[model samples]
Target: MSRLDTQIETQRLLLRVQRAEDFEYFAELQQDEEACRFIGGTAPRAAAWRKFLQMPGAWAVQGFGMFAVIEKSSGQWVGNIGPWHPEGWPGTEVGWALRRAAWGKGYAFEAAVASIDWAFDTLGWTEVIHSIDLDNVGSQELAKRLGSRNRGRGQLPAPFEDVVIDIWAQSREEWRARKR
Candidate 1:
């Protein structure tokens, strides 16, 4: 899909492909300790800038990347969620990381379901995976709610390769069947 056409809406959220205007919010998310803890821990603004650029870059280079999630109720940039498979990655991952303020509200699950559907139906992905930090109980629970099983351990790309995580996944067939 063209960058402008990458928009997915749900009952309470709008998932749009990342754009330059989203940098500030994205940077804010990366700088929040609680929010960035499992992802890569907090970073300074300079580092956050590089990280912010990755989402849009992924869409440009990989054709699929995290969606800048906006809450319909508040029209706020809550965080990002969707497909992510950087070089040397373990799997095509459907991941999520919301600003700390957006946690515990079911936004991640809601956006994730839409993302997974798009991945299977639009992106034609055979399976979807989530690399979750072993200690991230919240995400593990969300993965369970989505019918994903903790398959095993997995590795990430360089700079993060050493940070192993649990690979939670389900086939596209399983996801479609579960969504029914």
Candidate 2:
């Protein structure tokens, strides 16, 4: 997925791919326990920036994408929400992770709802996927808030428990109907 450093303006947040300037803030969240707990572990600063540098041009290269989530008001980064696939999963998996401080204000729901709109309306993807760590009840609840249904078990990458992962999904038709 190629989610470059392009900026997508939402009502309250600026959803962009990622940039080097965001490294420090990005590193902080990656190192945050509550933030990275469900997302696995923190990376070394150099490694984090190396990975950060890789995001700006993926959508053009890859058929599909990932993006860095940013708050428009403060220009501060809260977390990442994007589409990442695990092997040959049917569709692009849309996922998100936000800092603990950014929680409870409905930022996740607000920005993600717009991202979902872009996925179907802009990229023209017929189906979008959602998955989260089983123990991350807050995210599971957020999926419910976004109206995705659980599709059940699957294996994720390292540090992720090989437990029952809850898969949540939405089709283009479903999303379009929801809009009307």
Candidate 3:
């Protein structure tokens, strides 16, 4: 197994290990209600820190997890894009989130394409899933761009009500074909 910091680089971003200092920006981003509106809602500082600390373990156990997406040009942690294994999904789910300042740019799509390609080609993952809330048009669009076809409603239930997430997925073989 490779070390956690074996940085994954794309054309414009570098997905790397989480640092303690990242939580400040991570918490800030997570606290943004608009930024997290689709997933659920933002978390408090303490909760966000807990989540950040837990990420490395997830990577250790599953060989993958949400990675801090850093913009190589400025060395800023712009977002996170990778496989998410939230309970309820039958398969491994791929998810992403970026700060509001990073929106409207091609960052999300670019990060996703790289992750999906690596998940299939390099990492040897069989398939990838996406659990996106139905009304999260931005995420839904991003999933589509990744060549994932809508599967169905997600297991993310109430307080998250009215937010019946849609599932999207693609297999390794499928992803390879799409890239050609």
Per-residue lDDT of candidate 2, residues 93-159 (tens digit):
7778787778897888887887888777777778877866789899889888888888886666554
Ten-residue stretch with the least lDDT total in model 3:
154-163
Give the alpha carbon lDDT tens digit for every residue of 1-180 in model 1.
486469999999999977777778888888888888899899898988888888888988878899999999888899999999888878888999999899889999999999999989888999999999999999999999999999998877789878879999999999988878
- What is the TM-score of each predicted model, taking all chains together? 0.95, 0.85, 0.89
The local lDDT score (0 to 100) that residue 136 gets in candidate 3 is 85
Model 2 clash pairs are 1-64, 1-65, 2-58, 2-59, 4-56
lDDT of each: 0.90, 0.73, 0.78
- Relative to the unseen true structure, what is the C-alpha lDDT of residue 61 in candidate 2, on a scale of 0 to 100? 68
On TM-score, the candidate that comes out on top is: 1
What's the distance in Å from true for residue 34, model 1? Answer: 1.2
Pick by TM-score: 1 or 2, better one: 1
lDDT for residue 165 in candidate 3, whole number 0-100: 67
Ranking by lDDT: 1, 3, 2
**What would the per-residue lDDT of candidate 3 be over residues 32-148, giving only the tens digit for each residue?**
999988766889888888877766777787677778888889888887788666444457766788988789879888888877776776567899988777778888888888888
Q: Please give the TM-score that candidate 1 achieves against the real structure.
A: 0.95
